[model samples]
Target: MPNRCQRLLAAILLFAAPVHAETLLCHVTYGGETQDLEARPVSSPYTVPVQPIGSYFLFRIVFQKEPADLAAIKLYVFADRDSGPLPIQQATHPYPPLAGKGAGFGFTGLNQVYEPIRDGELQYWCEWSPSSGPAR
Candidate 1:
């Protein structure tokens, strides 16, 4: 009997373990092409390297992780360059019945461009957006 109970407990534990989000999908438009980038988690202010495209000094975008729902993630942005229009964007997800499952939901940033990398530092800043949501 004890053996059977242990087996059941093990099964329950296995299923109860949290399945962390595997990748944070960030979409951006570059040269009219929808580019898909996988975001890596970082400490402090959110930061992600992006491919350079245009003359725009500031970029704003949305990034998301799946298995998530109605909620959004809020954060501030900081870079080696000047990023203005502070007090970064706020939560926009408005589903009253569900909490998001993944990270990077409704995340917005006023990223600074680091174009033309110097001394091994990042030279491009990518701002993810909602239109760039997880899809092909």
Candidate 2:
């Protein structure tokens, strides 16, 4: 009698956990190279690595979901001269079936990042850009 009740309670609790319906994959292209990373669903944004300030990079984002519902992804840009980085620009895009690409505007600074709303791993590298040279 008691064992039967315990089993039923355990089954109910297991099904009560929240589940994510989608997964986002982001790829940062910089210095003629590309980086593939996974994004997390959280409030705080994850900073991705590119070249130093004045350099240019591109982002390739892919959206995958089970039910194929409507969703959106936001990108946050931050920059700094000597002090810490500050938010400069923020842009959001609707998640497409395939993927999307984004680029940093022509600017100069340090610790420049393209942060996503979800969690993702960031990679940094040194490369040359036509718009601006590598950071000093």
Candidate 3:
């Protein structure tokens, strides 16, 4: 039947389409305020931008999905200094994170990053979503 043939074709097309990159959502807290940062996969890790948090911290997230086998997600925390941003902490998680919904992946708990010089604290946690689109 033509209807059956059309359905088969549609299924094939769906499976053949490229996989959508996952989205990373990070909640960063500082100075009694919280900010949400969202990161999508990038071809080049160097292109990721640093986000300033309050007056003493900077944050960055890098998501990579290429080379399939080497895909990963990374989080960076920095101390905002007069000279420049200095790296304080780095966290990495493999692609297609095993930990499912709710539990989340990378830096799951209340992770506290400290700035040694000023004794400032930055708290953060991250979660991963299968896709950027709305739930089906």
Write down the lDDT of every candidate, Cα atoms only. Answer: 0.37, 0.39, 0.80
Candidate 2: tens digits of C-alpha lDDT, residues 8-112: 998998998655433444334444556544443433233434223223333322222223353445554454434555555544554432221223311111223
Tens digits of per-residue lDDT, candidate 3, 55-109, equal: 8888998889987876888889988888988898998777866563344434355
Backbone clash numbers for all candidates listed: 10, 2, 0
lDDT of 3: 0.80
Q: In model 2, where do residues sit more than 4 Å from their true spots?
A: 1-21, 43-72, 94-136
Ranked by TM-score, the better of candidates 1 and 2 is 2
Candidate with best TM-score = 3
What does each candidate score in C-alpha RMSD?
Answer: 10.8, 13.9, 6.0
TM-scores for all candidates: the values are: 0.29, 0.34, 0.74
Identify the leading candidate in terms of lDDT. Answer: 3
lDDT of 1 by residue, 1-136 (tens): 5698899999999999865533344444434454445553333223533333343322322343432552333322222244533332233422121333334332322223233433222122233323323422
Clashing pairs in 3: none
Instruction: Spell out the clash pairs found in candidate 2.
Output: 40-118, 40-119
lDDT of 1 at 53: 32
